[model samples]
Target chain A: MSQLKYALYTGCTARESTPELLSSTLAVAKKLGIELVLLDEASCCGASHLQDFDEFLAYVLNARNICYAEKHGLTMVTICNTCQINTAMTKHKLDHDAELRARVNEKLAEVGLEYKGTSEVKHFLYALVDDYGLEAISDKVTTPLSKYNIAPFYGCHNIRPSELQNESNGGENPYVPTSLDRLIEALEGNSVDYESKNKCCGFHVDLQAPETSNRLTGTALVDAIDNNADMVVTPCPLCHLNMDVKQHHAAKTMGRDVELPILHMPQMVGLALGCTEAELGLKHHVTKVAL
Target chain B: MSRKETHKKVTVKAFRFNAETDYLPYYKQYELEVGADDLVLDLLNQIKWEHDGSFSYRRSCRHGICGACGIKVNGKPVLACKQNAMELLELFNNELVFEPQSKKRAMKDMIIDKKDFWDKHEAVQPFVVADIEEHPEHETAMSIAQVENILDADYCIQCGSCHYACPALEVNEDYLGPAALTAAYRFTVDPRDEAGMERLELTAQMGSGVWDCVKCFECAQACPKEINPIEKITKLHNLQFEQKVARSNVATRHAEGFVHSIKKHGILDEGHLVAYSERAAVVKHIPEALAMFKKGKIVMPWNMPKSKNLDEIQKLVEISQTNKL
Candidate 1:
């Protein structure tokens, strides 16, 4: 029985595009003795698009997300990077701006909820490093990833917009971050060093410029591959979706077959901790990597 | 005398490259005792004056202004004049590698060829296009809110930090980097500018324009002035959407799909979002879709459960003062 529990906010992508991420996250969390209570009532946190359409609507939606998590009397943990940023950004904005909080609270009241701001919202990656302790996870590693070289891709929302996304605020980094690298080392893997580790995965802008977005993904993949990485891992399922499903497109942009498999943070951890491929739902990954 | 221990002996690997002399770039390691109060610029000056006089880097304002000392500390974009050296050193476990902001554009040690940045900025023609004949008084005639809107953006130092930090540049060289796009936005919002439409037109361009930004917010993080270039870029996106200026782009379509899906289902139906955005182009993803379907990643609409409290989501949007989609 683990004391650490969280209202798991599995963002839309995890529930839809990359269900493996959620399953793998569960498998890994189970091993760590952590309980992830689902925030099933929570809807999408606008995905950054809702902000462009209606900033207030996005705010209300995210505020409602926090409210659902607040109901559990636990900190909220998200698997997706966008979900992490959107909810945290909304919480920050509302907490800082009393008027906005009042307005959002009035809206929340309609749905039998109040914007109490009780729950601390964060990504599961941060939850592991912050609350669960890296030493605990490392100590439980039954199968060390000593033979593989992996590149950690800290997707944008995971470590960006540093003003609201600093380490203290439950983010990795706005500048270059080593949190992913530290996690990789904790798993007994040769964490590849590269400059573009914390850069955007270009998934957010993929629809706008497919070529440019593909190039962004390709460049990151090529960077990792060039650095002798066996595979790439990310805490963001949206990033995994792009790196997995859209890898062929990335190849077209780069004019090379850089087909390195992508792993969700939990899948990597789960694998290192002796979780079976079936248990982690590794088959769901469009790009298969043999460990 | 219990204070924060502020001094430490840290090893810094400063990048050394001379296009005129060296065939390849190399690092010159320096072990020095630096105070917690020392900035990156101070360290550079110390290296030049004491360690190696031949080491060259541009510095004028010594403060954060001029954007002259835009370089990468620990392989991340930052203004040497603005960032605390010891602070960054501590962040990266006391090992700092100082290098030119852009490797392809490096002219000398810590000096990049900024011609691309300037050329892109000039392409936007970042100057007011007001008609003096129609309303000359418009220059000084502006409300406080109007000035405030453009004030933060106007403070941009053009420190190619945003440019170097931008991941979009890796894909497209012609992609108008954040600093230039930021300049476009700063000028366009000015009340005196009559060429707002033209400026947006220039930026609304598909390849080398506003649409290319990957929304990483690196530009926002790298800015020493809190310019929030991503905010300006998204504002450009909103303005484009509001004005219906860039109606043909896939980005606009994607935004529309996102809004429509949220409004209809409360949660984005990923399958439908793609279907709506791509329309005919959705055929391209059929293979990918099939793969996901086999894995049960995509449960058909009937199989996928509806999100709970969607009526509340709709009500929230209905009551909130959201922009018309």
Candidate 2:
């Protein structure tokens, strides 16, 4: 096995809104012998909201985060899909456009920081499946979840718009992705095939149009339930919040009696690795998981 | 030559509605034995030609161009000519649900009124305004990098996928949809165009402008040409800031508050964000903020814990702000 080290960037959601995801990710990475060096000085990734308002600020903020990882001589790893895409998109833009790169670097020079474009931004899912191959992961599974039917939801940002994807980062086929499903199979679980598997959880519109969000969320959950999935595991914290926390709201809005448990990808891996429910934050989920 | 040997039976559920005849819009299923290489457009054409002449859909070029055949296949915006029927069948378990783009008034089967879409497009003035002194013979040379910047924006086919998938448009019809705003950005950055600032001014309005986008990214996904309209819109926002156009909107204030809170606390202070972003209207949100506090969604700014690395974050923020253009 190669020596693994990463400057872990826990975005606003994992750091503030859902610390359980952060804890479980740390616990799982440790178990897998991957070193996660925390970049405590990092601020928000300027999120999707900030990008809408000021794209330059978003680029500058993300470049700052990337600069932190480059300074430490480690690649950046993000647990949140939004953070991964924002940082990766900024990296792609800066790398391709020299003028933008020069401008961003000029701003960074004031802070004694420079992005040499050395570090790579990767989602935790890509790291687990690509860096730590499925075969290596299967070898470490002592508590194989043979009975559980898991629905692997690859939320939109993590995979789509193939321009952001690369070979090492799951090299996702934006239309039909199966890397998440493959990871679930490695954990000795059934990856339930269902409609709306690649659908949006509608987390973005939650504040503006709650009903639209609910309908979108409800459709995915209903599909998972119809296919008899024990739980829906996702790589995105926002998706987990919508599918797990606001599921009952979605169900009420859609007038359905659906109850499907949602798990962060790391939590599912931790559970199959014999980690306790409490340690994995299984108890924190609104939709109860029996395991 | 046998019917069973060449094609597989695929179920297509197409949206059917005629306002003059039907009271409500509904789906009508059709089972067609489609060839392996057949596109979704081919399937639609086959149905309309052989199976049912009454089935209505818009299509000019059988290929991916023209952009006239945009529809929702399994609730995702896609061009019918670009999507392979067999691949879609396998993905959707041999069943496909086709709907005319949502948020548009359905005219008939798989056809929706694009008048509003065209109106939004026209609002952006999607054309370059040439300088009167510049003659056609005196062509201005552009760098390779300059062309690459506007390349993606030029790939838009006016398919209405981005427009239909936009959450902002669903909420506020006035919001300039992704495609039009992308067009606005394309011309704004074009070296040959003389009306860059004018274009920015037109798109910087409070309601139906660049700031209205919610940044959902559905437009990027829905775009069959991979134009990534959201990225183009991001560039437009950057241009708006650089031009100092519409600097005092809630969106701009929200961004300022977001950065300020992050620098001060190393994490987002939601209370500060709402208060600062809302400005004088902060008083109006007092009841809402109290309700949120009661619900445990937020902590008061004074009571919030300072992040461990607030000092370092503040330095970075200070440098970035001081060096801002």
For TM-score, the strongest prediction is 1
Model 2: how far residue B46 lies from native, Å: 3.9
> Residue A204 deviation, candidate 2, in Å?
4.0
Q: Model 1 residue B149 lDDT? A: 78
How do the residues B213-265 of candidate 1 rate in per-residue lDDT, one tens digit apiece? 88788888888888888888878877776766766546666666666666566
Scored by lDDT, model 1 comes in at 0.82
Instruction: Kindly list the per-residue Cα lDDT of model 2 for residues B126-211, writing each as its tens digit.
Output: 89888556456675789998998796898888999989987667756787889999998888888889888887887877667766
Q: Write the per-residue lDDT of candidate 2 for residues A249-272, one digit (tens) a residue.
A: 789977899878788999989988
TM-score of each: 0.91, 0.79
Task: Note the clash tally of each candidate.
Answer: 0, 0
